[model samples]
Target chain A: MWPPGPRGQPRRVAPTIMNDTLLTVENLKTYFFTERGVFKSVDDVSFTVPRGKTVGIVGESGSGKSVTALSILRLVSAPGKIVGGRVMVSCRGVLQYAPTGTVDLLTLEESEMRRFRGGKIAMIFQEPMTSLNPVFTIGDQIEEAVALHQKELNEAQRWEQVLEVLRLVRIPDPERAARSYPHELSGGMRQRAMIAIALGCRPEILIADEPTTALDVTVQAQVLELLRELRERLGMSLILITHDLGVVAEQADEVIVMYAGKIVEQGTVRQIFSHPRHPYTRALLEALPTFHTTGRLRTIPGSVPSLAALPRGCSFQERCDRVQQRCREEDPELMVMGEGQVARCFFPEL
Target chain B: MGVYLFKRLLLIIPTFLGITLITFLIIQMAPGSPVSLKIQQMGGEGIRTETVSKAVIEQTKKLYGLDQPIHVQYLQWIKRLATFNFGDSYKDHRPVLTKIREALPVTLLLNFISIFLIYLISIPLGIFSALKSRTLLDQAVTVILFILYSLPSFWVAMILIIYLGGGEYLNLFPVAGISSQGVGELTRWGQFGNVLWHLVLPIIVLTYGGFAFLARLSRAQLLEVIRQDYIRTARAKGLSESAVILKHALRNSLIPLITLSGTLLPAMIGGSVVVEQIFSIPGMGKLGFEAVLSRDYPTVMAIAAIEALLTLVGILVSDLMYVWVDPRISFEGM
Candidate 1:
């Protein structure tokens, strides 16, 4: 048993994952040192992905969903730094920090982090059309992910593994699909190829960052179904980052709604959809054009606040329909409510 | 691919004919054929030709076969060319093909070696400078390459010769030609080294502008490519920094470099007139220049035909290179 730390201190990294929580992100902050001063791109955002389940991080463009995913991988590029907090990945033998098996990804050396990435946790990006290298065959690109991480596999076995992944993603004739270039395939097939590449290493955590945004609607449904089935079959923790609530509702077991670089609400998919608490979350649900509603789509009053010049208290304060005096003075923390649900609000709408 | 090649080969015939025809016409339009020049240079008896005898002038034209009309002469030239005879140089009374065979390889060697070095050095520098954009190293590369690019190659050649090949300085390499006097007596390897030793100054001059231009182009191209979404995907795949760059980013950046191939061969052979003249290396550029000044019509036409053919082939090779560099490009039509 590991010795307990001093009392009252916020545990930056929960020593290791139990059977349930596969990944824990604690008080995560990622800042960009730009000419326009320090931009808090992902400030005070934290979430956990339960094992064998999907966690959807939903946000509009520039709401830090992608940045948060990048931060978890410690891939925040130059001029951007993870200035605070920890991303505790479940350290198997692949990413052995200690015999206790926990690695604070933020603290891992770049080389160490590299071993964790693509080996233990791989990311499939948005823009499937562009994410795959144009010059390489889809099979070679998939095999590359395996080659870079799975050093134990021989060339023949790696080829087999790549073909196997292609088949897993329902790519018909895995041999031909592997030989096809990114431009040679349709957008949907390219997304499937991208998933094949992501799954090539048999990663414990697979981050699908807007994986279907550039795909067609029908293809989108198919791709989402494929991801859900893959997660169930492999028992891999999945993080689905998207701007589509419909995607979250269908695929996510847990959902985190982010606005202006901070999580505004967190709950089960049903709770967030049926009993949405935060004003921003409620506005987002109302804005969705549904077959159930006949009138014009209800638009949110104003645009999401820019992270550079966020207002004095709540980021949503300028646009909130029920803005209070206390909401003007200070930002509220996520207050826990029913069954692991929490929302950042001075007055919960529910 | 075969069809494309056949189509390209079909294009070259008319292109060759057009180039040869234009060169022949341009030379004919100018006053004085090679016979007339030879006659005048034969001295005082020829210039005041009536005194010497009119029959002698007529005999002179007959002797050189110069009395034929331009169209008849073109037919004869083409007939000879079909038999792989490029005709004899009127200036030297030597076969044009023989002269080209002797001189063209020197230019090709110099240009090819310089080009090889240019690509070898420039590509890595370009990648490094791009990866370090907005940093001191990038700015330094920009300033240095700009300065090198701005300095005229002719001037650079002269400066290199004076500093590296003159008595006042090092005299480390031969200032002219491509081999020492006893090159033939030396062993084969020694012969090559001797020629390379003589080539140092000219090679340096030839490579300076090329490497600078290529590096700047590659930097611009790589900067654009590495910013693409796929490049991010490459990094996110947990590739090492070098792999992200050299493997993932390099091929896309090289697409622009392939565009330069259409001009590379002809530019190497034809554009080296100054360097060849300054070094007196006896390459095609100098041969073409001397052929032009002496009104050696056959030699000039032969050089022009070869240059035009090379340019067309260069274009074909460029297309092939595109198919190789990017899988998105294929020779087969959709």
Candidate 2:
């Protein structure tokens, strides 16, 4: 996956290898086993990330967007378990399992999963200030990642690889920055160092859980631009989880609107924005105060349901403006509507 | 660092003076005066008690320079202390420096062994309990260590002497002093072994409390540190659980312990008074305790001065260590 150059030369993707599904999550149900029964954080959600494409997961707080990303890496802590799911991850150049051609990450052994992580798939988190180690130098942290995954490369080669990743993330003065501690760098540079570490293994898929949530608006724009450019240069799939619709609008090739731990609507970015099917999606779109929108910001009617005490039928029935009697009678199942678009609603807005 | 240390050393003088002043005042105001105490000890030893009249007491006081005004006596003592002259013992007239020199090493040995055991055993136990939290092993260790921590050192010492020292049922290790009477005749290794053997009961009593406290503290601290964002980042970087915990979380978690290192050395040299007394180890604690009991002003003031110096030096050293353990804590501009 290394782009051949003198380390810092900008590389361009050919655009012909973006057709295959890089990763597929099937009927994923990540539930929390608390003192009070099961709390279904992510109940029967499904999605896919195509190669070299971006999948945006947009939801309010506690919408299981972050949980979805954690489940992919099997990083969910105790009291919260991935009860049922198939996270089928395939390496870019090789099929790890010969017969099935893809590995179920959930069922993979811990050693195997470790090899898969940061090598085939990697994750970046929010809170760059807290996410980087305060003790070690930036170069040391990035070299740790490369040392763990790139076993074939010698120490000198790994050092070269670390320098390459640092340059690829556009960190100026790589040698000086590498020697500096995390606190010595500014917020933006710390985030860039984190990205350099994630890319140390040159993963094919990058799962960024609200990567820009902690940055200023201008810095957010720069980080988003970096992600977009890196995705092109590295030809990697990106799954971006965020609450800002503007972020999803700018970066997402496909958008997934989640409500109460379930996907309410999912489709191509343009189709979902133009023809929103679920009322939750419609309300979310209405809540945003766009340039052309008039009057005060139109807020949704009610708050999101808690996972512990969710509504019996449609989770959004209390908040849906066009809710009917049928919506209160039975739970809505995700039904396919348009080209690869799905909506979970008894009465979709469309 | 060198400059900071020099400044700290200069500050020790005022602190020592403050400590000795308070010790002198308390001794002067204490119930027993040195004249009456020395007179009583002489009478018990069949000396001419009836001839120890007021005139004799005044002569002895003048000889010892105790008949001077309180301020004048204090100034003389301070000047002597500046030249490492701790004066003589009120009880035996032996040099206070000689007595402290003998007792200091035993206390240092006791404290050193206890501190070594505390760190060597508790750190791993803390890391283990944290890693295995909510499991049966974690729960059992927590319950047992808490029980040890809650027990008073004096009571524990008594119980150990009773059971392990052959109080009633059986005699195992010798319970009195540092070694047996024939220790000087033994080989060097045998002498060392005898000293350590005699140290077991007192050291055990001293260290269990420290072990319990430090282990619990490190466990809670490590648990909190492992939850930090960087630890998660380490895990997400595909490091194994042990690698993530040992390499990344361990050093950061131990930062709090570095702050405690300042007190550790002093604590080791200041062996617990009750434990030392029960075991009769003749350590620094017992030396100070007996000196206070007999109103030995010079010995008491000398011990107080040394302790004050140690405390100041410990604080300065710990602050310097904080910078080493945490890169974010540099002593640059500040």
Candidate 3:
């Protein structure tokens, strides 16, 4: 067990579903040391994902959604470091620290972390154009991933696995596509290839960071469905990071809504979507253009607060329509609302 | 691709002709004349009055083919140039083509060996510096390479000669010429060994400058490529840092480096003139230098033509390599 201190103090609550918990991130803070100063991109935040369930971290750009995912993999490189947090991941009944898991991804002797990265956890990036190597054929790249993770597999088996995953991601003519370079394929195909690569190793957790954002809307729908199908078939947990609330509705069982590097609302998908508590969540819901409404979608009046020079009280106070005098003086802690729902706000809508 | 190559090949004609024409005019316009130099050398200190007469000048002009019209001579040179016949050297009385052919192999061999060594040493060093960028190793390499690059080739060559050429210390390598003795008597391996040994000083001087430039360029290119998204993807896919660097970043980085390497060919050839002079190696550079000093118009023009051709060939090879390295580049479009 890690030493208990102000920095590593555990939130006094019963650990939830230990057996099913695949990844647990507690009060994670990631800071970037820039020329100006240290910018806390991912301030204190926490979330958990059960095995075989998809958890969506929804936020607009710069909301630290992607940073949270990156921090989990310990992929946040220089200028950025996880100053404080415990990322506990349960692997085969053993609870290991996730960020610096039992292998200490942050401090993991490079060799050990190298083993954990592609083998235990893998990530799919946002832009497929920039994500895949243009010079190498898709087949060679996927085979390399397989070979890196499953070193015991013979060359023939590795090729077979690559073809199989390529098929799993529903890439048409897997063999032909495998030989093609990144530019030869359309954007959707490239994204599918990326997913195929991430799924190649059957990782315990797959971090899909806006994997479908670059594709066309129809293609985005299909990619999302493909992800759902893969997750279901493989029985793997997924952390889907996106700004699209619609994607969360379709793909996620639970949702964590982040605003300005802090989680504003955390609950089951139905609870957060139907009866959102935080004022920022309500603003987000209002901002979503709906077929049921004919008028212009309501816009949040002001921008999210800057992390460096945040206001004394709520970070979203300047933009909140329901802000009170007390709200300007004191920041509210995350408090439990109804069953399985938590909102960080002093006042919650019934 | 074929069409691109055809167009490039066609462009070479005007380019070569332009170079040949300019070289001819430049040689003619220069203050010294090969004819006068020849006459002066042949006449000697106590020349007879009859030998120094206008009749002797006319005879010298006729003997050297300078009596022909300038345009007609240019045409003749072009006609021979098309067939790779570079006329005769005024200084040695040997055919210019034969002289160039004899000297070219030595220059080519030296440049080739120096380039090979540069790559062998620089690439790993470049990659290492890039990987450990901002570290002491990177700082040390950057400083050393910068110093080496700034140093003059002749100065470096002189230092090598002084230290290795038995300057009160040790005689580790041969001081001059490409071969130890006559070329025919040396066995095949012995000949190769002799050439290599003779090349040590020149290669060191050339490699010091060349390796520094290439390493710095490669390191910069690699730093950019490493920051690219594909490299990040490779790492995310669980590839070891070494795998990400070698398989992903390095190849993409080499694309720009290939273009740089192509441009460096002419530079290497240019640098070899000083190198050849310092080592006393009988290469094209030395021949060209001698031709310039002695006012050998034909030899100078021929060397100029060869240099132009080499530059074109280097660019052509680089364009071709682009297709090989990146499939997306359509040569026909260019």
The model with the greater lDDT, 1 or 3, is 1
Candidate 3, residues A105-154: lDDT per residue as tens digits?
45444565565576667899999999999899999989888987777789
The alpha-carbon deviation from the true structure for residue A337 of candidate 3, after best TM-score superposition, in angstroms, is 1.4
Off by over 4 Å in 1: A1-19, A92-98, B30-72
lDDT of each: 0.86, 0.86, 0.83
Please give the range of 10 consecutive residues that has the lowest summed lDDT in model 1 chain B: B43-52
By TM-score, how accurate is candidate 1?
Answer: 0.93
Predicted candidate 2 versus true structure: per-residue lDDT over A1-350, tens digit per residue = 23221344432212233348888898999999999878899999899899899999999999999998999989998789999979886544733322223567887778767876887789999999999988899999999999987777898998888889999999999989989999998888888899999999778999999999998888889989999999999999999999999899889999999888899899999978889898888888888888898878988877887799987789999888788898888998988879988899877776
Badly placed stretches (over 4 Å) of model 2 are: A1-19, A94-100, A293-295, B1-7, B45-51, B166-168
Best by DockQ: 2
Model 3, DockQ value? 0.72
iRMS per model, in Å, is 1.0, 0.7, 1.0
Pairs of residues at least 3 apart in sequence or in different chains that clash in candidate 1: none
